[model samples]
Every structure is written in structure tokens, then in C-alpha cells.
Target: MSAIACASLSALVAPSLCRALPALAVAPRLLTAFPTATRQPAALSRRMVTSASLTPTIEDILVEDHRQFGEIMRRYNLATEKAEKKAALAELIRQVAVHSVGEEKILYPILEKIAIKGDAKAVIARERQEHKQVRDMLYDLLDRNLPVGDPLFERDVEAMYKYLAAHCAGEEVSDCPEMARFFPESARREFGKRFLAVKKLAEDQVAEEILDMESKINL
Candidate 1:
């Protein structure tokens, strides 16, 4: 299955929705295992090196990240334990922040250059605005360290999901396909490598910030 199609299916069976179905007993375990099979860029690179023929494209990397984010969100929403919820939320924020930064720095710039200049600029601007909104929500969630059951926490989580889902839909339907048309096969693979590097840097920075915050809270 295509990465995008897999992600869409995973999102449908996410804990929140699956809980209402007859398969609820197995859903959690299935959902938990689903993320383990996702393709990370490092792993993809290694496979490509071994095969020397099948390289992942930039869209593949992005779609994989989106799936990871969706799975993390599902974990957060379904987590009954405080620690589980906290970990899920932290990872969700980290992934979303990393993906947004990578897109803005790497993908959107390439899109702007290759696409019709005016239209690309407008699209990038709108996407950036959405990213800003998501970042603000994430910062508030991280800064407060509120209990998962808190009303404010639930509200913010819902809001974050709504914005993120909309943004993902837009990208999958419009931006990614359009951008893919402009890049050659080799360039797309190279871009995937760069995107993964940027994502790792972003994830490390966010992890450090989270650790620092926790240290201060403990003090």
C-alpha cells in the first residue's frame, strides 16, 4: 500500500474511533504495533544502500512522518494512564514541530522555486500561518504541563488535532503532488535525505528543551 493510503487507514482505526467498534479488544494492540512498522528515513537509507535501486522519495518520507504523528495522537487520545498520556503528547509535539520546520526550511522553498512564483508564495504563506498556530498550541501544552484530564488540556489537544488534520489533508491533496512533479527522481531522493536530517536535528532540540523544562519543574 502507498504510505499515504496506509496513513489514512491507520487514522481511521485510531483508538478514538476504534473504541466504538466490535474489534475494540484487539484494536489497541494492533494500533500499538502499527507504528513499529513505519519507515524511518535512516532505515530507508540503509535499505536503499543495500539494494542500490529502490530509493525513497521526499513524499514518502513526509507521508511516513505524518503516519507517525497520527499514531502518536491516537496514543495520546486513548491513554488512560498519566505517564502514557504525557509521553504521547511530548512525542506528538516533537514530531509536529520537526515536520513543520523541515517543510518550511526545505520543502516549501523548493516548491516556491519550481512552482508558479506567485501561487507558490501564497500557498507557503498560508501553510506557515497554520504552522505558527500549531506551534503556539504545542508551546502552551508543553509550558503548562497540565494533567491530561484537565479541561484545558483536552480542549487544546482537540484544537491541535483539528488544525493538524486539516493541514495534512491539504498537503496530501494539493501541495505534495504538485511539488513531486517538479523534482526528478534523484533530486526527490536527495531531498528525502535532507528532510530526515533536518527532522532529527529538530527532534533533538525539542527533546533537550523538554528535559530542561522537566528539570526546572522538579527543582
Candidate 2:
């Protein structure tokens, strides 16, 4: 949203509806511009590398993402102040939301195309369901309809933390290794490069999500 518009909003509504824009904040309602679960960069390239590889595979990259998620949670757990915890949670939500885009759009489809384990479809379905649950929990935490002081807010945060930890463990042990088994080093690296590129494209959306959730944390 334009500065004048946001200033007017701040004047007319609770400061919480439109706080001072953070360094990463984009236009107001930018989060609403993209669909909740499917927000992604339209121009993300799908090219594959044909040559032998010298770098990490998609499995490696996915593991790194899991590690990052774990670290975010770790810090959130350590945080004492409400502002600190909310800020960390906003970032965690943003990272998880964007990370799902590359994994679902780019990585999971290979398994759908050809599966030696015969459970690719079932696995993808389960993973997608879990991703939806995480997204929903974040929305519940910030939903304006809920009592601003509701105890459910704390319950949802703790529940999501446990749920996300288990989800990451599943991907780290099972899904990521499946990526390794399915693709050779060169192909894996090529797909990994593409996934990373798409993630970069989602940077603005990530920032918008963080700002949106942060603004909603009135507690």
C-alpha cells in the first residue's frame, strides 16, 4: 500500500492494523494478493542441468532448510519477551510457507512421475495435508475473530511448534533421502539450484507474511 494510505489507516484504526512498516515490509495487503498456500514466483525457471555435478543435491538443500527451521524454533523457545517470541514466530511462519512452494512444485513431482517405493502419491498427499495444517495454525493464531487475549493463542503456538518439529524430522529422514535415491548428483543439483532460485523469488512475499503476522500479534 502507498505511504499516504497506510498513514490514513494508522490514523483511523488501531495502530496494530498498520504499524510502522518494518524494513522488510512491502505494500499493505500484499500478503492477500497471493493465494494463501500457492503463492510463488511466476517466472521461476525449470531448467535442468545436463552435466555432472560438483555441488549439493536437492536432498542436501532440503536438509539445510530443516536445520534452519529447527534453529528458528530453538530461538523462539529461548525468547522471553512477547515481542521477541512473536517476531521469531512470524519469521518461522514465513520461512515454512515459502519453503513449501519449492518442495511441492519442484521436488515432490519427481516422485509422482516415477516411484520405486510405490508410495509416492500417498506420501505426497500426506505431506501436503501436513503443510496445510501448519498454514492453518498460523492463520488461527492471527485471526482477528479470536479473543485478543485467548488462551488458544498460546496453545496453538505450542502445538504448531511440536507439529513442525515432527514434520521436519519426517522430511529429513524419509523425504529428503528419497530425493537422493531418485535423482543423480547432477540432476539433484540442477533441481536444487532451481528450488533455491524460486525461494529467492519469494523473498518479498516472505517479508510481507512476516509483517502481516507481526502486526496481528497484539498480545
Candidate 3:
């Protein structure tokens, strides 16, 4: 989305949506343009990194997660049939788990190595704790056989989604610059490939776990 569209969106939406819309609108541009405002010329030159050299920094990846989460929330709100909602919730659970694990496996370690004081390692550390808590809730949801909208499951899923949104914010504001610093061009290209490979492995692991659960249930 363009700046004009964002400005238009801000005028018409509630404050909360207004705040969130910028990331939704601007994220793709940020990935491509890597705007000077969010990144420093020195950082870019020091790294000699171009947009194509990296797939997406943790910020970009998390922005995509937020977009997906927002879509799921919107679908859940609009769903009328119990079956449909349940299916949507199941899909949401799958996506969120995959996203979280991929980030933890591929992104956080890099952040921990490069993070500096003003870069908000404290916030990122707290967010990592939140990820563990949220992952526990997701695992509980995975183990349950209950219907969708079961109070406990719904509560846990909502909590996890909320945590993700806040977590994404911290990463974008606090940890993004560190990414530019840590992932200079050659390193970014190599890490980008590794990140995707790890994410694919994580997805396969989730599939295997689901299969194991299904076998145990004779389903």
C-alpha cells in the first residue's frame, strides 16, 4: 500500500487499526525499498546488503505473521457455522505454531548474538519468554480433542495471538536494526537460505507430529 492509502486508512479507522495498518500497508515496501528511515545508510553500506540478498529479516517475517493472524481473527469473527469456525481455528493453530517455531529456530539466535543495549534485548528476551508460554498453550490446544470455541482452547488461542502481535512489535522496533547489522550481504544471503530450509523442516516436523497423533487416535 502507498503512503496515501495509509493516510486514508488512518483517517477512517479506529486508533488501534490505524496503528496496525501501517505495518500491513508498509511492510512489503520495507522489504523491497528498505527505507532509509528504518535503516541507516551506514548500516546498509557497512553490510553492503541489498534487498535481494536477504529473504526477509525477522521483522518482515513477523509482519507476515501478523497479517495472517489478523486474517484468521477476521475469519473467526465472521464465521457462523461451528464446523467452519472450528476448521478455521485449527488452521490458525497450525500456521501460528509453524511461524513461532520457525522464528525461534531461525531468527532469535541471530538476534541474541547481535543485539545491543538500546536495541532492546530486554524486550526481546521478555518476548522469548512469552513465546514459551504461548507455545505451551498451543501445545495444549494441539492435544485437545474438544470442539472449537471450547472456552479453555479459545482463551489460550486468543492469548497466544495477542502475545504474537506484541512480540512482533518489539522485534520491529527493538531488534530490526540489529538484523541489518548482523546480517550483512553475504551472511544475509546465506542465512536467508538457511531460514527457509529450517522453516521447511519445521513444517515437516509439525506434519509428522500430527500424523503421530492421528495414528494414536486411529484416525
> Which candidate order results from sorting by TM-score in descending order?
1, 2, 3
Q: After superposition on all CA atoms, how large is the RMSD of candidate 3?
A: 13.8
Cα lDDT of model 2 by residue, 105-176, tens digit: 666565455443445466555666677677666777678544333567667677777777676655555565
- Taking every candidate in turn, the Cα RMSD to the unseen true structure, in Å, is 13.6, 15.7, 13.8
Q: Which stretches of candidate 2 lie over 4 Å from their true place?
A: 1-55, 116-118, 144-151, 205-210
Clashing residue pairs in candidate 2 (N, C-alpha, C atoms within 3 angstroms): 1-27, 1-28
Write the number of the candidate with greater lDDT, choosing between 2 and 3. Answer: 2
lDDT of 1: 0.57
Native-to-model Cα distance after best TM-score fit, residue 189 in candidate 3, in Å: 4.4
lDDT of 1 by residue, 1-219 (tens): 233322321232212111100000000111111112233333432333334555467777676667787889899788888778777776665566667767766666665554444655666566666776666665666568676768887887787787787777556555556545554566677777676666666665556655553332210
Candidate 1's TM-score: 0.68
Tell me each candidate's TM-score: 0.68, 0.67, 0.61
Please report, in order, the local distance difference test score of every candidate based on alpha carbons: 0.57, 0.56, 0.51
Model 3 lDDT per residue over 128-203, tens place: 5666666555555557765556776567557656666665654555455555544454454445555556556556
Model 1: runs farther than 4 Å from truth?
Answer: 1-55, 142-145, 210-219
